[model samples]
Target chain A: MRHYTAEQIAELPSKYRAHFINSCTGFKSANLLGSISEDGITNVAIFSSVTHLGSNPPLLGFILRPTTVDRNTYENLKKTGVFTVNHVNQNFIKEAHKTSAKYDGTVSEFDKTLLNEEYLDDFKAPYVQQSRIKLGCTFENEYFIKENDCHFIIGRIQHIYVDREIQAEDGWLNLERAQTVCIDGLDGYALPQILNRFTYAQPDQPVNSIKDLGS
Target chain B: MRHYTAEQIAELPSKYRAHFINSCTGFKSANLLGSISEDGITNVAIFSSVTHLGSNPPLLGFILRPTTVDRNTYENLKKTGVFTVNHVNQNFIKEAHKTSAKYDGTVSEFDKTLLNEEYLDDFKAPYVQQSRIKLGCTFENEYFIKENDCHFIIGRIQHIYVDREIQAEDGWLNLERAQTVCIDGLDGYALPQILNRFTYAQPDQPVNSIKDLGS
Candidate 1:
């Protein structure tokens, strides 16, 4: 096992450090954050930081790098107050990954990549037509991380669109059937297959799979 | 696509709603948070919200649901001010998942689960010996989410231990090679195979795989 102290990690090259630090956290939730400017320009970027903040209010949060550069997603989200979070699947991994390419404010990634942007139910932001599961969200709040200068953008899930077949009767999503691909580090895309879904954990008895119990 | 509005989602049964909302976000990072109390009792729990907060300061964050229930992980983390984040790999995913079972405070999850605990270099926390990648972290700060009573705990990475074989020259980790798994919803564990690793995207050129460029 190789161990690195804080000092060593800080002294490493910026690019090397970025990759190491990003991957060290483990597998991240991969989502395409789609937003549009008031003037009608759409922007979608690949984000692996999307996290489930709360289930009661259906809140989700993602970390946004500092606005040192012109961040179209942050700008548009703040302006329009809404955005869409779309899951990246195996079928469109390449196209979904392409959105990470930084384009100028005038260019829409949808025009260049294989992804198609569709407006549904008059939502201000566009949703990825290829995504099997997607959420329409409105900005709830933002908090700045004093340690890193990054902003934590929290959004409330307002609308959910999922394929009927992939959803279970108990409301759990079968991501394996949906073919949603997870991200490893910055660029590695991996397909995930569901091993099993266990029931709510109890104290003493061994953990039991919901399927086995129901069967 | 089946669509659910906020109102519709709210009307769902509590357990069903939890599943629907939790799984709707996307894939989550699967990690075992190892923490020890002041009295020398160790605790390990599976966490899906471990997120890369930033690389500059090398910070990570995870959400702890309302402390309504006796959360040993949260209580121990606060008591000791240090913990370890260990990635769950295929070899020990079941062991990692079992840590989520509500064990009594006196009974360490490490003793119950198949995972072996190791105290490396006298670190306040114990590392999962089975985890190929792990981080020794110190409690930095936390923010309470108003929408839900969840607390966002932030920790600064102080030490990192990784198997040298999985570390790439570019500082990226080949998780597929490590047999690391990604979590689907609460109880589903899934292994991810690396499909492709792309280079930094450029607007002009098409997305290129790092292997193709480097090879």
Candidate 2:
């Protein structure tokens, strides 16, 4: 087995960072837009650091960079305590990726990307109408990871929209079929392919008699 | 645009959950082994919920089912607070899947599956020798999703082993080259494909002008 010294591992290129690698492949992108301004929307930003925090409370979280520089999404979320997570598919990847650009606070990404926008009920935040899945979230708590200049913005999922026909027996939607993308590194996307299926069981046991881990 | 009512969305099958869909396709199988006997060896189990939490401190997390049923991994982790996150590559998926079978505490899944094992720095937990990437993690926190009854086990990565060539320029490692797999729902794995790379920028702006989000 070949071994790299600590220095070698440390000196490994930035491409070696898991985040960058994941980013290069294409990550699930979301447009975080919220309502704050009367005549204008407060902020519209995109993020890939999002993950499912919990399903019971239907919680989700994403890392937001701190407010050293003026950030529209951060400012708007702080002011309104509400945001939208709009899923990006292959068709909208270019537009979604564009949301990472730094623009003046007055510029709206939705108008630039030509992506349609929809609003739910009385919720102030607008959802991306073109997105296959969109979630309306209320801000919960933010945990800062000091080592990295990222903040975990936890949000309770208040509303969700999913395309039909992709739902499975176990209550999960098949995202790959919906052509959703996964990210690696800074500018990559990964198209997914199904391989095989096996029963769920503890990692230490035999092959037969696989039992469900969750009741 | 077709619209589904809330009742229809709720009735959407388990397969429709985006998390399960994405998870089913990308994950490969692996054995979670523990030593239950005085032999100081290993007991094996299988899991697909293992995910990289972050890299700064090199953290990883996996879901462990609760103690309602007799699970060797759940019990062993509860007893020892130590476990291994073994990657299941194309070569060892079958054997790795076998580790999920229900086995008595006394019956070692390691004895059942055809996986070889190795150790790191005298660490009590054994790593999967067949896996391209393996890591030793110490238990940090466990959050129970009361609604779903699934336990999210967060671990601090103690050791990480990866094949060198796949590492990229920006600190992203290419798992597809490493033959990594992702899980969806209960029993599926997916192979990931690279599509394209485009710079990230805020909405409505030119992609090339956008700076790295990490910056």
Candidate 3:
């Protein structure tokens, strides 16, 4: 086993520390956030921070690094008040990752990468055509983390489009069936194989697989 | 493709809606949050909302649902001001998920489930002996998400213990190698097989795997 105290971690090289700390947390959800400038220049960038916030209002949130430099996705989404969250799948991990490369403000990543853009349901933002699961979200709210100059941006799910094959009868979407990729650190992508789905847990009984119930 | 507008989603049954919305956000990092009450009782619960907040200070955050009910993990961490985050793995998915079973406040999930607890380096909280990657963290700050009655709790990484086998030369931990499982929804666990690790992206160059560089 390897051990690192706080002091030791702080003394590590910056890049090495970034990779170490990032991957140490565990697997992160991978998605491409698609937004468009007021001029209609579309921007798509890969984000690992998209997290499910709640289910009642169908809200989701992602951490936006401080806008110290030009953050086109933040700027565009704030300006347009809408953006799309597209799941990065196994087939397009390469193209999806390329979206993270720093491109000029006016130059759209859609044009530079192989990822094609499609506007769904007259939504102002563009969606990655290859993503099997997509969500059209409206900007909700953001809270600034005082410990770090990061914005926790929240969005409301206004619309959803999913491949029919991946959804189970109980409404759970089979991510492995959808081939949605998860990110490790900043660059490693992985495909998950569903091992088991348990039924609603109870204190007195042993865990039972949902498959055991013939679902 | 199945399309659902905001109204349609809001109209679905609560359980069905939760399953739909939770799985739609892509795979989530799964871990067990271990905390100890002042009276010395330990609590460990499965958390899928754990997300990387930053790397420089080595910070992580997770969403805590409203404490309208008995949330021993929340109360213990708040009182003790420390907790441990242990990654869920392939071998213990059943035992890990069982942590979510609502046991009485006096009952420790660690004792109820097969997970054994080991205290490390005089840390107030207990670490899961079965986990390959473990983090001892101090509560830093929390932001109240007014949109949903939830709290985004932040923690500073003070200690890290990892199995040596999963680390890469450049400091990234190979989560797949570690056999860490990702969460599909509330109850579904999946193990990820790493597909590729890419080098830092540049706008002008095509994506290249780190393996290509012979690292």
Candidate 4:
């Protein structure tokens, strides 16, 4: 086992430290955030920080790095007040990752990559046609992380589009079946296989797989 | 494709809605947070919201649901000002999931589950010995998510203990090699296999896998 104190981690090469810190957090969500500028330019970028905030209100949040640099997705969403979160599946991992390249504001990632932009139900924002599962969301709020100068942007799920086959009767999504790839670090993409799904846990009772319920 | 509008989602059965909303965000990080109270009562609980905030300060944050119920992990870390984030591996998925059972403050999840707690280097928190990668962190600051009454707790990484063999020369840890599992929904566990690690993206250049670099 290798032990690294805060000083050692801080002193490491900047690029190496970024990789180490990013990967140490564990697997992150892989999604392409689709937005359209008011000028009719569509933008798509990959994000790994999307997190479920509350189910009751169907709220989700993702961390955005400081806006010191030009952020096309942020600017577009701020102007339009809506964006789409599309799952990055195994089939389009390369194209999805390509969206991360620093293209200028004038150029849309959809034009540069193989990802196609599809407008769903006049949602004002475009969705990735290749995504099996996607969400149409409206910007709700943003909180500033003073420690890191990052922004935690919150959005409310306004619409959900998913392939009917991948959803269970109980509403759980089999992401593996959807072929949604997860991010290992900044650049490592991994496909996951479902190992087990357990039932709701309770004290003093054995944890049993939901498979035991024969669902 | 099945489409669910916001109104339709809001009207869903509570359990079904929870599952639907939770899994839609994509894969989440799987970690067990270990903390001890000042009086020496230890607690461990599974968390899926752990996220990388920044690298310069080596910051990480996780969302803690509203403190309406007893939150031992939050309370203990608050008291001791220190805690540990341990990656959940394939071997201990069941044990890690069991920690979600509402174990009271008097009873430690470590005692009830198969997890063994090992104190590392005078840190106030206990690290899960079964976890291949673990970090000791101190409470840095927290922001209240007013929209949902959740707390976004930030922690500064103080100490990192990892298996050297799993890390690459670039300082990225192959989480797949560590057998670290990712959470699909609230209860599903999945093991991931790396498909490819791409190099940094650049405009006008093809996205190439790191394997092409012969690293």
Q: Give the runs in model 2 whose Cα sits over 4 Å from its true position.
A: A1-46, A65-75, A104-106, A112-114, A140-153, A199-215, B1-54, B61-83, B91-107, B138-158, B169-171, B200-215
Report fnat in order of the candidates: 0.83, 0.38, 0.89, 0.87
Candidate 3: residue A178 lDDT (0-100): 88
TM-score of each candidate structure, all chains considered together: 0.95, 0.71, 0.97, 0.97
Query: Per-residue alpha-carbon lDDT of model 3 for A25-89, expressed as tens digits?
Result: 89999999999999989899999999999999999999987463238998998899999999999
Per-residue CA lDDT of model 2 for B48-155, tens digit only, reads 445445554455455565553326666666667777766567666667667666666666666777787777667777777887666666677666644445666666
Per-candidate clashes, comma-separated: 0, 79, 0, 0
Residue A205 error for model 3, in Å? Answer: 2.1
List, residue by residue over A1-215, the lDDT tens digit for candidate 2. 33433344445554355453232222233334444444456444555556554444456556565553227777777777888776667677677666666766677767677666677766787777777766677777765545444555667666666666554545555656656666554565566666555555554533443232222
Residue pairs of candidate 3 with colliding backbone atoms: none
Global CA lDDT computed for model 2:
0.56
lDDT per residue (tens digit) for residues B1-215 in model 4? 89999999999999999988999999999999999887788988899999998889999999987463238888887778999999999998999999888867788888999999999888989999999999999999989999888999999999999998889888998998899999988899999999998888888689988862113
lDDT accuracy of residue B62 in candidate 2: 54
How accurate locally is residue B65 in candidate 4, as Cα lDDT from 0 to 100?
71
Candidate 1 lDDT:
0.85
Q: Model 1's DockQ? A: 0.79
Cα lDDT listed for each candidate = 0.85, 0.56, 0.90, 0.90
Better of 2 and 3 by DockQ: 3
* Candidate 1 local lDDT, A107-192, one digit each (tens): 99889898889888889899999999999999999988788778888999999999988988788898878888888887888888
Clashing pairs in 1: none
